[model samples]
Target: MTLASGLTLTVVLALVSVVALVMRPRGTSTVDFYLAGQRVGVATNAWAICGDYFSAASFLGVAAAVYATGLDGAWYAVGFAAGFVPVLLFVAAPLRRFGEFSIPDFLGRRLGSERVRLVAVGVVQLVILSYLVPQTVGSGITWELLVGQGVAGLSPYATGIVVSTAVVAALVSFGGMRGTTWTQAVQFLLLLGALLWLAATVIGEGFHYGDAVEQISTAPLGNPAPDGGLATEPNALHPGEPAVFGEPGARYDVLGQIALMVTLAMGTAGLPHVMNRYFTSPTGSAARTTTVWVLCLAGVFYAVAVMLGTAAREIVPGAVADNPWLDELTVDGVLTVPEHALPVLGRIYGGDAGLGVVAAGALIAVLSTIAGLLLAAAASWGHDVYERHLNPRATQRQAVRAGRITTLVTAGTAAGIGLVLRPEAFAASTPSIVATMVTWAFAVAGSALTPVFLLSIWWRRTTAAGAVAGMTTGVVVVIAMLTAGTVADGSPWPDLLLAPTLLAAPLTTVVTVVVSRSTAPPPDVERSWLIMHGTAADRHTQALARLVLAESRRRRREVRRARR
Candidate 1:
């Protein structure tokens, strides 16, 4: 049925996010619009970060990957969650300490380099766009399956992308950070709830996880071995399953797996939208705390997704085709669209309303992520470009106006890209398409920008030139890979997990250090350190207030001593 029951749940989620936007206090200041006046608390900000980070990939892709492969797909979740560990240890607190609206702001002011800011801005925009389009496409694919209406000269896929993008843009434009944060926190909880609920119901249905694994192990995963060898379907439940493991593809090696993990983990620090949330925290310490919380939240959610993927394989064999939307999207009985697995299972277990809820949650996931990315784009353009470059004399109101304009423009640009390369079905399934784009972004950010940011904050020797060189090398390598047909379908090595990042990131760091050693460092590197690492004024004020109270107690003791 159109607007499947599970989709109804999704509608409620979207409505709730919208209500949050409408009910939030109108923002009047730049700080409020950009960083929610920097007043977000630790727990709330952490949850919001989870909402932003989860995205379509975590919610849909993780489960789909597991369902497609066996245990190997679980690596996606592990890699994604592990990225936060580095963020907490090296990046989060220092990032907030700088008190910038976006990553470019921090780098620009820290190095007093306008060129650095511009380059950073360009990279940030590229990464954000790359990340944003797939999400829009994912939303469209989901809507097509759930709603089935080709409205306004658009297919269901296109309609989903437009509607979802518009909703997020509206929320970000009107509600700003305050409303967006609250909605995202709530949405994350709902997403977790949906995942946990599905897991519980699946387990309760008496599906044995171990038994399922053994059952799967019996088959030739995705394909069989030919002539009783690995060439033909080896076993029905084992590696013969081409739909899951690329039955017709090559197996990845250990080095490749390590590279994939490194790419994802290091790349966390470079994601523009996720980094933007740091500005919302009250202090660096709070941002660190938020990362810790996010780690826990991500751990639980990912584990559940892995379990659900296994269950989907065992419980509903050929269930992909039974669902109305799945029939259109799947290739034969197998899912061409791995992203649809979890949502399809939701319908199978919960009926129409269950499907609606899961679908809506998926939509909400995209909406929240898009809103965050759009805001990051706005902050980068408005603060870094219009204010810093074009109109240094502009007032706060003017800056806010610039920000709004940029938000609209960035959102439109992202939507345009999503439309131009939009896939007919399972766009994400293509080896060099959605997944490749995402990996390229990760490679760029991790290889170039992340190392510089970490060294800038931690190592005293990192020069401004070093930072620029590193970022440049990283971006150039990743871009070249993307354009060079490195990841084209049926390519031998492109599908390897670390084929891009593992090779490119080290080159970026080497270039950075080499260039840095040859050039004189910034004159006020010490002063920049103070600015980036120093405690916030408000935090110091509170400390002084506490000290004064302690002094008063000491004075009373002295007076008592004198009198006695």
Candidate 2:
């Protein structure tokens, strides 16, 4: 790495460490450790949520997708941004109103069954592991490009995975959710700022976005072939036609587009890490407001990503003549690894310093996301599994300790998995493997957890047996389809298999309803609904906060009078 790049990365990591240490939980209270004492404000939580939500997938993968597939790649950004809508409309308020430490805790309590909790815990862990691996993979990819060297006798990729996981594991274990919250919020701002800076720099260099898109659309879409050469991808929608940069058929057809969007949208509601953030909100109303801010922020971030991707498509080829280093990274003016789009653009526009900024943003994205996933895993294994089932009378300190241990184990496991799975092995199959892998996680959550989660909230008749049955069916069907898709490559049903949420989610819902009809509902369904849908808890929390603020103000006034 260049001196500027190394210094930039070091500074960013230092800032993150300082923030985590400064915001570490103050007590042994489980609530404080896991949910930040339920005191995080809406705006801060929203930024942290954005940090958690926009993983390496958003920072690198989305731009890479747009760089490779053009219009089809832009859909990844759209779907990602749209995913929050369901959370805002159906999930945020109710989920916070019925506050709990994790998804499994909420479901287990709502359904009044240990069996349900255990099953949900299993599904949640699967989701977290799936999500965690991608963040590690992204870190590895960034390290491969940024540092270009490994430490401790490891390859650059492996080194990246190990270092990132270790640093983030330590942060989460020490800081818990409170420390993580502040760090994530800061990380997200830095990420946004990096993108904005790159955008302005690019646009200032006479890059007309509209003209660029129109100009780039004139040629057939080309990517690196398996044989280390450029090849034009055939249009899936228009059988004999060549795919173009501004068109849709470069990647997905109509069904594929819809399926991908639906999967991502529904998956947001079921994501354990993201949903857990809602529990940190002071009130249900604040959670709802947080979602609003998240939507607005995410929309801006993705829009810029899409624009930058387009700019890269138009700008990179012309600049390749000047930068000799670009030869190996590109084939016939097209990037071999789509994820390198933003970093490459950074180098082209601002040299090593610019590359450092974007690369640091990418690493921060991975770090922030991994922290959230680790905390979510800790909540599941430590709180839901160890404390609740293994030792019901466990002290708060013990539970918190268990959570820290879980964080380390989970991070280690994910790093191992990331090492085993090489991005180059699957690069030929998708525009951005990091983005695609994350979408699979989304598919699992959407299919297995979201349908059941939504039903348990909206349908009183959703019995524990029904939920178990639905979750099992969703997991089975999604896995089966994904496995079949891998084995049956080039099949006409690739879209359906790749994004099985459309099929799996509906099927899971049907199974849930069918099983629920035959089984008895929870006895406390009315009470659960009152807690979930009712606004009384929100009002109560708001009143308490106002009272506390008023009392503080009165005390300050008295102190001032005494001084006079």
Candidate 3:
């Protein structure tokens, strides 16, 4: 099985490399390297964004959360899928219309302040690093299970981290956004295909979804104990009550649930990699259309993930007697590490081949996301920092070279962080550490970046000073709350503190508005607003497209007459 799995993984990586090489940017132009020449169509960008958005957190963590905590875990998927809605409504079109390389680029230019851009770069890097480390962690976890061997004296886990980061960094550095975009789009299809295959196999095995949920609900949820035994979890919502598989209290309480959802939902608008995909659109309308497709596609992907999580809970326990490997992975039918639920299910129904498909899917999830994050980091450092400030007169080739260097540095940094924080140290304390860490990134983005991002677009009075202050305040408040929550783990209000977007976002908004009112707006505020909210650019793009279509039709008619 390990050999077969290794072969499958090698094939997937080879195919990804081929795509990156084939689609590599033709020139060193910043536009080509960073935004794919602004030529990515609606469908391709939609698929790529889905690939970027659905990380290991979405692939493994969501399922693991569901397998571990039941209904409460389902919210992770719900929140993740819901996050796109705000993007569609308030962000997608305007962001593209603004026409900048990244979030920092847009904020800096819109507010007419270099200080705003630099401050935004700082916040965006924090968000990217926050998001990047977990992906490396997830890769390590998957590799540890799938291969179960080490390279060069490194543990299997460390090897996974180092290998994944290196491969993805090289792909991003060489292929740039053009190559990365196509590879990501293809990878997303593969990820979805793997999930669909698993779902079909489970259903074919006479598994009934509703009945399974009801059956599992009959018993209290049990997790792996510290002593390598089974222990029932207490309900956080209802103290003294045993957590149930079909209920909400297995992980978060009422307030915690709301906070988690809000953090995730609003955070999508602020994520640098996800939001940067919007800039690759040819027009604002195309960006909006791409987002619609993303919503539909993401909806299906997450729904399937939720179903599989439920399926794993129902089926794995009963199959333990038949599969010897299950003895070590599970405790009395429950997975010791909930993230293993999908891979274990794959092996049970499909044999080693099935496990290969699922394991490859997990690695692809991590790799695709890592590629996007590295690109985002590169754009920030190369375009935002080096090109704009360090050497304003840098040539196009120099700028692109800087981006490649940034990608390598960022990947190395993330890998180092992943190594320092081993999974064994925190696995017992969290339901799905991948998902939880991702939520923290969401909390920071929603609290700090989202409020200011929306304000800069919607509010004409938004000043650079106001935006800076709001972002700074948001970062400080979220960090303080998260730290306090960690320190006071057993307290009732820890849920709110841990997922602090609910508290941090509104306060940030108020601060932004108040500060903006007190200060004079940017001198060209009206012009920026028109560019952001007006349809002039969309209209021009439509006109040009019509002219091109007309010319093509004329040429085709001429060829037909000549043939006759």
Candidate 4:
């Protein structure tokens, strides 16, 4: 059965590669490679946006978090869905309108400073790498479960990390953004379809969502003990009390709540991979429209994810108890590995095929995200750094080659880091390490880039120095606090430092405001402001008038020639 599932995974990866090959850029220009020549339409870009945004964290991590923490875990989903709101209202259209190949490129040109561009490239790479590692971890987890074997003494998890990274790196190098965009859009449908089918099947099997929540609520959430044999442990949200499912505070404190939401919501706007896709839209208005569609699909995806998590809370334990082989995976009523909740439920309901579909969706989530991340990395390194600084006179082919090489290097680095982390070793009853790691990336991006990004767009006073200061403050505070929290042993510091956006974001904002007041604005501020905020309709009208005037001039020239 595992072999059969592995075969399914192979076929899916091959198909995606073929799709990338078909959509591969026909030209060698950076525009063609980085932005798909800015030709993608609204609907396709929306799906690709979903594929980019809904990584392993959203697909498997969210459900697993909910399974472990009850309604408290659903905060991840809520934060994720709510994140798109800020993107739509603030960043999407204007970002595309002021578009470049990547965020670093935009900030560099906007600020009129090469230093600002270089600094942004460093931050964007950090954000991308932070985001990429979790997807690789997720692929390994899915592979370990579905394949149940490894090659040449390597762990199945390690094999998965290598294979998934290699495949996506090839796709980005071969297909570039155009190929990756098409594949991502299609893969997202596969992801959404898989989630919907499983959710529907379980509910139809007399699994009451309300009852599942109520039953779990009556007892404190207890997860399988870390010792891994037969012991079980209680994961109480309140030290001595059972946590309820339909409410807040089960997984977060008030500070945690505010920090998580702010980080997730604002973080969406600053995600390098996510924002890079906006440049692919054919028009600024199309980018805005694409975000609306993303919001719709994301709402559906996460809502179904929450329901499936609740279903797992009811189903997997019972199913495991009836089967001897499941003992290693679950102890008593608790799952040893909370991340397996979705796949375990798939097997329980629709048998092997269900398991394969669900498992493949997990890999697809990883693949789609890795493709976008790799592309973002390429843009940052190749366009933002290499082309901008090292090779101003380089040819299109040379730039594309540089980007491909960067993609491979970035993919390898992420895979190497992921293997080192071995995320499975630290899994627990609470939001698993994979989910928590993702929040770190979001927190840093939000605290550092989001505030400065938004201020640069809306405020006329924002300067290059301010942008750099804000981002630097954010990066330093987030990394320092998260490191201290990880090493420290305590309640208040860990909780607050773990989700530090509440503290770090304000600090970043202050630095940005103070620095901007002291520094002068970019010299092209008036023109840049017009470009960023001009109505899409105005551009459309202007383009149409230009075309009409050109045609009229051509007609007059023909008449004069005929008269002569």
User: Which candidate tops lDDT?
Assistant: 2
lDDT, model 3, position 263: 92
How high is each candidate's TM-score? 0.86, 0.95, 0.94, 0.93
What are the lDDT figures for the candidates, one per model? Answer: 0.74, 0.93, 0.93, 0.86
Ranking by lDDT: 2, 3, 4, 1
* lDDT of residue 55 for candidate 1: 83
* Better candidate by TM-score, 1 or 3: 3
Clash total of candidate 1: 47
| Backbone clashes, each candidate | 47, 0, 0, 0
* lDDT at residue 374 of model 4 (Cα atoms): 96
Weakest ten-residue segment in model 3 by summed lDDT: 534-543
Off by over 4 Å in 2: 537-564
Global local distance difference test of model 4 = 0.86
Candidate 1 lDDT, tens digit per residue, 1-564?
A: 444653574566566567666645465677888898999999899889988988877777677667665665676778889989999888888788878888888887777788889988988888888788878877876787667687779977788888888877877777778888888888888788888888887888787788888776666454211222223212223344343332322233455566667888888898988988998899888999889999998999888888887787676555654666556545544455556777777878788776776777787678778888888888898888998889999888888888878878887887887876654333333321344346556766787678777777786677777788888888888777655534465655453433367777788778877887898777877766765666677557656877999999999999999999
Across 508-538, the per-residue lDDT of candidate 2 in tens digits comes to 9999999999999989887788778867866
| Candidate 4 segments exceeding 4 Å error | 1-3, 228-247, 536-564
| RMSD of candidate 1 to true structure, Å | 7.2
Model 1: which ten-residue window has the lowest total lDDT? 224-233
RMSD of each: 7.2, 7.4, 7.6, 4.4
Task: Please provide the root mean square deviation of candidate 2 (C-alpha atoms, Å).
Answer: 7.4
Q: Flag regions of model 1 displaced more than 4 Å.
A: 1-14, 17-19, 22-26, 223-251, 318-332, 422-436, 485-492, 496-499, 531-564
The positional error of residue 180 in candidate 4, measured at the CA in angstroms, is 0.2
Candidate 3 has which clashing residue pairs, if any? none
